[model samples]
Target: MVHHTMTTNSTSASRASSRISSMSRFLVLAAIVGMLAACGSVPLPPMEVAPPRPAAAAGTPTAPDDGAPLPGPIVQGRSRWQPVRWSELPGFDTDETYEAWNAWLKSCERAPAPFAALCPEVRRLSLASPQEQRAWMMQRLQPYRVEPLNGPAEGLLTGYYEPMLEASRRPTASQNVPLYRPPATLGSRRPWYTRQEIDTLPEARAALRGREIAYVADPLDALVLQIQGSGRVRIAEPDGSVRTVRLAFAGSNDQPYRSVGGWLLQQGLLRDASWPGIKAWAVQNPQRVNEMLWSNPRTVFFREEPLSEFDASFGPRGAQGVPLTPGRSIAVDKDSIPYGTPVWLVSQGPVTSLQRLVLAQDTGSAITGAVRADYFAGWGPEAGELAGRLKQPLRLWVLWPK
Candidate 1:
């Protein structure tokens, strides 16, 4: 009787485990389906499928070679362009040096006028051999060093697989696979000093002032990191501009989707303000709020300029059949790709025809090197669409400059 009872208990436990596993699988599938539905309906472009290899050919050895070296510095217009190999670049990738420099700067009694004040010292030290730089950096930072692992306890790290969905193709059984494992913990690792605290330190101030300055900017361009609050989104720009865009929520309590923007417009929200009256109307009609929000066409916008009289040989036409802002449109440096270089980009994977003539009108903090660029799709709906669709590898060439 005891043996029989133990067998029944074991069987019951196995069945319970099986049921739980089944439920987890179902939840994952549901999440995938919901994500696909949220993306809405847009016909995918033709895929450039790679040719299949035979089983015997798969094992064939290829020639041993390093990747293409950085192309030699090319000159265009007034500026000289040198290829910036990030891994090979001096003063970058030296975590200890940066940490030391940062710590020393913080220890100072006054805020260095600008962040670049320490750059020259950094450059001088970096000119030494890598080992020398490491030693020097460690020595400088040692005075300010804190225990690396000392911090407040946080939550446990978890691991799980997430399903992958292709924007250009329908979901297949193969695409659903586990993929993510987060770190074990992210504790309260604080900066050594706050800005205000750093500004007050005399030694820190003097050290920074003595150091070399590299790059400093006013009105920096900030990237949009995340949406915060109900009506604001954060922006980071190249000019060092960091701020939040406040949005105007126009929808009624019944319908939350009817929103317009100062954020939306600047970030390319509405094509135009055709529905100025819609917000007030939305507030009154709670029952029809969702319908009202859904009915209006969402639009995106970019600042418009008359296309140049330059011939169609330049590129695509504007609404009135004239050349669009030829050089002013997005472009990369030719030395980098000169200001007006037109690029044809081919994307990787299923989404095809991700074509645009992006003029490199602006630069980014991390956007250096011959291959780097910033593509500006027109603002509002157009920009949002392009940004959302731009998840694949890009191959670009300066068609006109070359």
Candidate 2:
């Protein structure tokens, strides 16, 4: 029997790992249509004029944070920031500003140049009233409507979460699927062996000999763990002890990601390419499971990390190198919103409604576009359900210190 203890991390995998369940699996249809639509991608037009700036604070001006002169509207690779009034933000005054403070404080752990100077004040306000926090934000920062270079302010918002599973420290009859650490020859080639080659080629398997971190019962579970990039695994050890540990993204085979769900859809295998749907298909076509698994050439490797009482409270380190707050942390395209920036997000959809402050503390490969974001829904089955179904429209406003 596998022992069940739990640990976690807030690393890059949490941001990008849920691609399997979050969007790639469930939104396969959309992905197919998008691929068809992008066959003739063309250059975008120049950005438009900026909106009117918000009214200045009453007090006399002080030098901007970082001691740099306040620049005008900024343009990013895929997005543009157009100065706008605080009032322009939807439900801005009603959000529980203090709830977001924790995420902001985490961002300050590795705040970028523009926000590093503001961390002192951010820390001081941790205990301040919600009203006070909101006031400080308006007084010190300017709100910018984040829009695409040549598109609208609206974009896609998906969701991701850490997965928890059971395992064994060593291979067993049931737990035959092995999770691996990086191979010594991982980088010997431009891109390490593909997932199929790793399974069928003796040379590829030879390279990974003795690199097994743990073994699980189901190949699909291993695939899900790899997709999530980091997960909590309850392991039954040879010492007759069961403990939970985190599997973090150590490295990958360097192959481009290919969604198996999308591949299944393309093959006319299933219309509902969500995780459950894929699982059902696998059950029906047991002999072809490898064919489905191999659809994604990319194979991610992980290293085990000990989970502690305090560490369990937060998520794996994100791309920004900080533990992510469950509801308040977000993965944005760094080119659109730099890591550590505070963003005002507004989205209303069937699953939920959100009008609050979130931190740009993480990033994912699929989380591109100016207003696009991947909401971290936390861990466990409930979070998994939400992450699986959360695909919605979104708008964004970034707050920069004045």
Candidate 3:
């Protein structure tokens, strides 16, 4: 829930990977959201809340009592990029290069400018030692600190994950809730039907009669899959065959993404904005779960993707058009850290902590500002738990081509 405090409610990074329903900004909020509006949190300031600022920016290269010397801000795409010494990046030497290299290999598949040329060598060096990898990096890259436009040098770091659920090919007595594919005429419509209509309207239900890819028992799990915009469902097919498949973002109803957690907070139904709290509310008012869901008018549609043995191990494609590397792939504001760029990230918070090498392999609408990022935590329940709880102060350095 803490990480979700700074997340986006619209089309998520995975949606950003595809067309998703929406593309917007993430806020430094106190929200606990899930995929597409399903169960993950978005990044935004709470309604009417403003971002906090640093203590002060001392102009000189003053050696502070604690960490590295913070630099003054310089202009960038709606933010600031300040020159900093590589020595200032904490734990750079300690981070393993193997994980980041694998993530980079995936980035090379789409190959953003200037990075493609380095891929051949990157591959050649894949089997090299970490020390050698570090040497190559230092020889080829320069570091720059990122900050908010005209603001301080710090920002928030949060995580997002793929929530896993169980499903059945055909609806059963308990698994009646359907995850539908987009209507064939979805593109022809602008603002499509709302969540309420999809749930209660006969016409809307009829519009999706034969389009269900899989059916699950829990509405919360379904919603989490929607909000995250990507998920893995362990399905029991009609032949009694059981296997896992990915439900990707096919389209959306074009309705505005509203925060269900925030709504519950306003109604005084819960104190903590988290999946646990929301589930508790649902348990107490079992009959009104649909009511809570309808509070969010937006609806996400999915297209089922058959999973390969290898694909099952990786994540769904992200905004950068590459599979996400758990703990290594981060969703950024393309305006600041362009897709395919390497980033050195550091953050310490209540729910999560990290100091590592990562790649800008995805984007999110709410992932704006110079230093913000949404760490893709990978799939399933453990990942979702981490994503929901991870909210911390972040510091980033773009490892640019020298």
Name the best candidate (by TM-score): 2
Candidate 1 lDDT score relative to the true structure: 0.24
Candidate 3, 1-402: lDDT as tens digits:
101222322222222222222111111112234322222222332212112222222331222224445445456576667766656677766677887888999888988887888889889878866656766776666678776776455677767776678899999999989999998767777898899988788988888889989999888767767767777788998999999887877778888666676666656776655555677778899887878888878778887888899987777787777778888988888888888998988887666658789998877655677877788888765676677656567888887775
TM-score of each: 0.23, 0.83, 0.82
Worst 10 residues of 3 by lDDT: 20-29
Best by lDDT: 2
Residue 376 of model 1 has an lDDT of: 29
Q: Which wins on TM-score, candidate 1 or candidate 2?
A: 2
**lDDT per residue, candidate 1, 1-402, as tens digits?**
000000011111100000000000012222111110011112223423323322222333322213545455444442333432222222222223332332222212122233234445555653344345433332232111001122221111000111111110112243221111111111222222222232356743443342211111110000010000011223333365644332111111111111222222333433332223223333465565434323312211111112233321232221112222322233232244443232333333342333332333323222234443323232233333332232233434332210
Q: What TM-score, to 2 decimals, does candidate 3 have?
A: 0.82
Name the regions of candidate 2 deviating beyond 4 angstroms. Answer: 1-71
Summarize candidate 2's per-residue lDDT along 307-346 as a digit string, tens digits: 9998888777788888878889888888889989999988
Model 2 Cα RMSD, Å?
8.0
Query: Which lDDT values do the candidates have, in the order given?
Result: 0.24, 0.71, 0.69
Model 2 TM-score (2 dp): 0.83
